[model samples]
Target: MVKRKSPLRKFLFYFGLVIIASIILIPFYYMLIVSFHADYDPYKTSFNNLTLRNYAEIFGLIQSTEEAFFGDEITKRNLESINTKLERLKSISASKESYLTYVEETLIPEKEKELRNMIELIMDFSGLTPENREEYLQNAMKIGTKEYNEIMENAQIILSEGDITLLNDLYYFLNNYKSEEFLDKELAKVKEQINELEEQKQKIIAEKATEFPFLKYMKNSLMFAGLGALFSLIFAMLGGYAISRLRFRGKGMLQRSVLVVYLFGGTVIMVPLYQMAVKLGILSTPFGAGVYLIIVYIIQTLPVSLYMLGNYFRTIPYSIEEAAIIDGCTRMQTILKIIIPLSAPAIVTVYIYAFMIGWNEYLFASAFLGLKSYKDLFTLPIGLNAFSQSAHSVWGRLMAASLVSAVPIIIIFSLMEKYLTAGFTAGGVKE
Candidate 1:
């Protein structure tokens, strides 16, 4: 027989859904509206106007200096080239004797000797023997006065090229290249400009930093939600299987125990848990804190997870497991290959629930992670609190951060809600 759902029930369900949705969306809407507001004074209740200046400032697009765009390499290369030119000028100006010696060694050797010999022959032209004169005349043109004159001319040419007047001037006045008064005036102006720009950038960065905390908090919320869902699914599947298939003693007691744990509040054991964490040195570092928090979350989430999965497992027929065994399958195989596939919706529901519990948890996070030095180790809740306390709290940026953090979770839930509901209801209905 098919049974139709009552219209009153449908109306109530939709009404409840609407209320829940509003509860979730109102804060986000408020944040989005505020993020567009330009007035930054936290004490002032009213906003002056909406502007993109705050966002631009945070991103370093507006009022940014040219220096910010340039890398260190360009500056370094310029400095190096300047230094190299300075060193070359200094070397040239340091020793005139060394410069002359270089010229003598390089340019005067072959030409000077030949030219001196030719000058001797010209002066002794009448007294020279025929053979001697012939020998002198033959070699004279090749290695004598004419050759020496040519070499001297070449040396003059080389010396003209090697003239150090420009280099000497540069070396002598390198220190005074820029006048002190001029440099000081230019430097002051540049510093003043930099200071103004830096101040503006700082203001924008401060606003954006405030927003980052809330965004981080939102991520923490999602992480916890996902973890909770996973734990819940495991518990639901295992617990359901045990109750449905096993003929164990104290089954009723076990069921009641699971319920008792679920009913147990986290506040009751907060002190002891804190002490245990301290003793174990879990409070010493961020990683330790995360470990402690995960443990606490697992303990808190286990019971409900077990109950949800156990209930789901109970709804499946025992005949299916028996049929699998008859088909030469092991119990593990039957459960993995048969039962789990059928209980997908229930598993998904448990996973989602567990994830939510972990994601939303704040009390334990705040209490246990009270130290300020380990603030980075803190979850989203702690980060949000820190953001709220900072000066120049721009509500718009905060809202932006909040929205960025939340949109993912909302999307995931919206897509999976149908499957999760189906799993939950399937576990509830048993033949």
Candidate 2:
């Protein structure tokens, strides 16, 4: 006998579904709103006005410059000296490689002259010559020694020292000086500057190298997701078949074991898995992280996948396999040709589920990968995390990144929703 759902019960069921749908969509809705909101403050709760400032900042269209003052001047001087040294090293290295070319080619002479002229122009603009360099050093020493002595002699004398008077003196000395001695001093200063530039360049290069991994993170993530999906689907097919068709001792137990894994909770395994990853030296490496993430996702998705496909497989009559065998088709051929085609909807469901699991995974990603600088190996989720941190809690940019991250998943699910729903429902209802 058939029974109709009570009006109140039906109303409650629809109301609950509406609530669940709203809950699922709230994050995405917030993400969209924030992405568009211009003045969304990360620090404040006040949402007074909307502005694109956060988005502009994230995209590097806007930036703040540090104001240079008297104190910063000394730091600037040191940086200039370091930069000069680095330039000299680069020139020396390049010259060493192209010594023969420099000696033989007219083009090389022209280029060298142009480079030398450019360097001289820069030095002139900065008021940095051999005389200036020497004067700067002399003033630096005098200020340090004299200031310390003055402070020690009578703390009140500190005010009497005045506002870096030595800097004015050094500037005057460079402005007035013009002799062979001055030229020699200038040449020596230029050489020192070149050496300093070389060192600064090397430091910059090292810093950039440190950030290289973050660049590759996206590529690695995509590769990992693709491979993980492929491997999981292949394995899930076999696991699903074993659970569905093969009658063996403990078959029911094996089916129930998958449910137990789901009940056990993913968080419980995180610590042990992380320890194993660290022990295996896979923590920092892309291959290790990718493989580990794949394993985690496969295990996490396996029970559901197996159960879903197993139920689908159960609906198929054994006579289909028998008829294939009568046609002289091998077991593998029969499964591939007959069974797989019939289970296309289920396979698609499992594929989508596995892909989504891989795409949205974060815990293993955060635990396995220590730094965000490994950009090359970043998945969309990891990239979004990095983008959020880079934005320094700016909600608009963070939401923008979040919105971008979700677009792919949304598109995928939207396209497969019908098939997925059908597969899920079919797996539940047996004829």
Candidate 3:
């Protein structure tokens, strides 16, 4: 018989666990907060300033928008002034002629020569003869149905192919008129042009992010880590089963050798591993680095994975194997059908360990794949290392990158956590 824990003891144990959990989680919490807030200072925290801009910047959104909004600075500033003047006029009762006179004398002349020069430039670019310049200007000024269709068609083509600076000049020429009615009509057309340009920019932005090397690096990391984990799992399973069940000379020595290798930390073997990679001529290439890293990870993590699985295998009753053999199952078939099924939990545990080792092993990845020429081979760790070396560091962006690198590990572990507790059970069979 065993004595149950007292309620006080259980409460104390849970409280202690909570404290330790909080301690472990605080750094992650801080990192998440910093990732969303630019110029974050612990002493001056403000929730209102938290934004997704850092993430947008990382994924190429912010830069794309800026590029799309190019050539519109003067138009924006001049529009503000025009709006203010219009608002002032609204406060007073004035005849249409008075408004027109005010605009003609004050607004048009201020940028009239500038607008005319822009119009002449556009006419030359459009291959319109000088005689047709006056005709196009007349057509543009009419703000009629024919003018609308012609300008919209021509504007679309110009916007699609010409520099944005030309578009800006064209918008200013049409919209900076002295007539109130003309201003309103041209302003509407300008707004429509803005919308079309924005849509074109959106199309460009969609394809632009693929150009970012970090995205490629992330894909490479996922592929390499997955392959490494898969190979490691297989080797660990086979090595573990053989050592645990098969009779062979030097088997004990093999197990001891695994333990000895496992005891050796990564730092101790870094130099030798790099030397070996150079000797093998596997450095700097994606496939080469990937294969080398997978092998290294298997060697480094296999001992622990093997030890865990081997002990678990030893716990299964020998009678189960004997029964399988009596039923005419071969050794390989019995191990596959019986042992592996019973060892699912341990396998999952080992897989998670191996996957994490591959995914997050920064030192090896950086040393092996950290050449500027090996752009495709660069992993998240290497990307982050290079990003951090920029003269101006955006802590928010750095933290976001860190979070991106960590998410796969977090998700995999979270989903598979339940299976881990089922490993190495002694309840295989009983008589």
TM-score against truth, every candidate: 0.55, 0.59, 0.57
> Candidate 1 residues 226-266, lDDT tens each?
55456556655666687778889988987787656645567
lDDT of 3 at 4: 100
Candidate achieving the largest lDDT = 3
Candidate 3, which segments miss by more than 4 Å at Cα? 1-22, 39-48, 56-214, 415-431
Q: Number of clashes in model 2?
A: 40
Q: Which runs in model 2 stand beyond 4 Å of their true positions?
A: 1-27, 37-219, 371-373, 391-394, 422-431
TM match of model 1 to true structure:
0.55
**Candidate achieving higher lDDT, 1 or 2:** 2
Residue by residue across 1-431, what tens digits does model 3's lDDT show? 99899999999999999999999999899789888865423234454467887677666566634234222343334445555554555432244555456556765665555545544555556665645656666565433556445554555565455544554554554465555666566555545655555555455445443334556777877777777778877887888889889999988887886557755778889999999989888874667877887787677676667777788799899899999999999988988999999988777777776666676778787778775246667777777777677433446777887887788777876787665444324211100
Locate the minimum summed-lDDT window of 10 residues in model 3: 422-431
Question: With candidate 1 superimposed using the best TM-score fit, by how many Å does residue 173's alpha carbon deviate from the native?
Answer: 31
* lDDT of model 1, residue 379: 65
The lDDT for every candidate, in the order shown, is 0.59, 0.60, 0.66
Clash statistics: count for each candidate: 19, 40, 0
What's the ranking of the predictions by TM-score, best on top? 2, 3, 1
